[model samples]
Target chain A: MKFGVVTFPGSNCDYDAYAAVRHILKEEVEFLWHKSEDLKGCDVVVLPGGFSYGDYLRAGAIARFSPIMNRVIKFASAGGMVIGICNGFQVLTESGLLPGALIRNTHLRFSCKFVNLKVENNATPYTSACRRGEIIRIPIAHGEGNYYNFVGDIKALEDSGRVVFRYVNSRGEAAIEANPNGSINNIAGIINEEGNVLGMMPHPERAVEDILGSADGLKVFESIRAACASLLNTVGGK
Target chain B: MNNDSKKAVVYVRLKDGVLDPQGITIQKALVQMGYKDFLSVRSGRFFELEIKADSADIDRKVDEICSKLLANPVIEKFEVEKK
Candidate 1:
């Protein structure tokens, strides 16, 4: 199970993502530079969080045009697993790999804190480890974390089960107070139509270690590993 | 020159109901300065463009820029006014 984490020029969480997969999960991990056009032999490609390209011309705007994005698009199209976290989520939406868009926080301020997320759908490979409606805590830090889609489009996402994660409170209840960045419907994460590509604003890697105060995030990575292992076994059997 | 007569104003703003993180930051600063009268503030981009194309074609070209480069229609609203 070789996992690859893409590192853009200003990416700050590539190491964190690598450590979570390689050291914590004890899975084979590699660094894929933003300019690299190869994704051979990689089971999962991660777009880690960071202020890529200094976020100069809007978050993920310039990074989406990078040469490597072509490869990422190809990988996703072929049913490959791809996860984008935080700023990485911004990039996915910018590249049209994901639907909707991340906007400035409704409060118009950068928010950095642990947020409770409700697993809306666990049927996909990314959230198979999580039970539907289960609440998990993850840290989110970003200026543009608010997510929006047309009302009709949002309805479609909900109907299609693409609306995966929603912000919640400590008591496991959804409310305005728990809506950290004012994302519509409190959406913290979503998946593409194929369910192979996921983009979320929270940082699961940051919560993977118990020493960091929580190990809840490990379930996310573990789930992916399990899914990939099963996939490999299925291919071998065939 | 006659060609410079075509002008347009481009108004780019974040979609309604979406958060304006940068605008919120600025509002906070203004509040600290004792300007408590402001209920809310939203920041946006404005461009005054003069093109060489005639009115008939300029609208289409400007629309392309708005959808492709000037503004991301996903989270932004853009308005064009002839000048």
Candidate 2:
């Protein structure tokens, strides 16, 4: 499957996503500049992490209006698969592809470290490779990863199993201390209601290599590959 | 050259139920400096915009920008004051 990694003005992790797909996943991937309106026929779109637009006005607020995001929004609405990491997650929330908003960290500091995330729901395409309740270690680096929304919306997200990942301790328990940015219910990631779009604060590309501290993040890409392959086969069979 | 400009100030604050870590930190600092009795604190930001006086429906335009770019409707509310 072809993957498109969007490169916004201040995007620093675009290469990470590109390399992970090209070298590690051995998939067809291309860089989609923010100014370009074309998606280049990519099956999946990856919005990499960085301080897009210098986090001006708000994190991901300005970048949300980039030309490519207009297409990304359309693509997402059409049920295309999209994965957003770190600041990319911020952009997704700002673009309204996902729900809620990421606010300032509860501790009022930038946190960068390896964090354990439990697979809250393995049913979605993003986490299908993960076993339910499995704990995966990934790196999270950000200052405004705190997630917030109305109490009712948060409850709805929980009730519907839209929460894909949750920060948790080593034992796979969601504990207050394990929440790096004070996200509600320790939400490390979530999938949109349609189940095609995913936004997560952790850097899965950064953790895909064993030398980088953890290889567990490869499961996410693997899950996407499996889902896409099955979908193609099902379509081609008809 | 015609110069008829008006300034509008937009203030954005997090919704009441949302947590404001920065505001809480500032409140703590106030207590540390030996100043108590401040029940609570909330932090917010503002933006200043200059619009042409001849612009029609300035309020609507300002409100549009506030909801679209200046503030996130899910977490923040913006107030615009024309001066």
Candidate 3:
């Protein structure tokens, strides 16, 4: 499957995502500029992490108005696959493709460290390769990763199983200590109702290699590939 | 001489019940510095917009921008004041 990594002004992880897909995953991938409206027929779009638009007005706020996001929003609404990482996650929320908003960390500091995340629900296209309750170590770097939603909305998110991942400790338990950014219910990632889009604060592309400290993040890419291949096969059979 | 420029200020603030870590941190700092009477603090931001004085729909335009770009309605509420 072809992947398109969007490069907004100030996007630093666009290369990381491109490299992960092309060099590691060995998939066809290209960079999509913020000013271009073309997605280049990519099957999946990856909004890589970075301080887009210098985090002006608010993180991901200005970037949401970029010309490229219009296409991304339309593509996602049509059930296309999209994965947003870190600042990308912020953009997703700002674009209204996902619920909730990420606010300042409860501690009010930029936290940069490897944290364990438990698979909350593995049924979505993004986490299909993960086993429920399994813990994987991934690094998080941000000062405003504290995810928030209305209390009722959060309950709905949990009840609908749209919550895809949660912060967890070594034993796969969602504990307060493991909640690095003070996200409500320790939420680390979530998927849209259609399950076509996913937004997560952890940097999976940064953790795709064991040499980079952990290879656990590769499963996310593998899951997407598997899902796409099966989808292609089903269409071919018809 | 004709002056045609007008100014509008938009205040964006986090909704009540939403935790404001920065404000809380400032409150704590105040206590540490012996300003203990300051029990609570809230933080917000404002934007100044210059618009045409002759615009008939200035209010609507400012409100639209406040909702669309200046503030995230989900977590924030914005007030537009014309000056």
Better of 1 and 3 by TM-score: 3
Which pairs in model 1 have colliding backbones?
A: A106-B19, A108-B20, A108-B21
Task: Compute the lDDT for candidate 3.
Answer: 0.93
**In candidate 2, what are the lDDT values of residues B1-83, reduced to their tens digit?**
23688898999998888899999999999999888988679999999888888999888989999999999999999898888
Q: What is the lDDT of residue A21 in candidate 1?
A: 96
- Best by the TM-score measure: 3
Pick out the ten consecutive residues of candidate 2 chain B with the lowest summed lDDT.
Answer: B1-10
Please provide, for model 3 over A1-238, each residue's C-alpha lDDT reduced to its tens digit, 9 standing for 90 to 100. 7899999999999999999889899999999999999999898999999999999988999999999999999999998899999999999999999999999999988999999999989898888888988888889999999999999999999999988999998988889999998999999999998999999999999999999999889889989998888877877822
Q: What are the Cα lDDT values of the candidates?
A: 0.88, 0.93, 0.93
Candidate 1's C-alpha runs over 4 A off are: B1-11, B15-42, B46-66, B79-83
TM-score for each model: 0.85, 0.97, 0.98
Q: Score the docking of each candidate (DockQ).
A: 0.49, 0.92, 0.93
Put down candidate 1 lDDT per residue, A1-238, tens digits, no spaces: 9899999999999999999999999999999988889875789999999999999657998888887888998889999999999999999998889989888787766899888999989998888889989998889999898888889989999899998889998777779999998888888999999889999999999999889877878888998998899999999922
TM-score of 1: 0.85
Q: Is candidate 1 or candidate 2 better by TM-score?
A: 2
Error of 1 at A192 (Å): 1.3
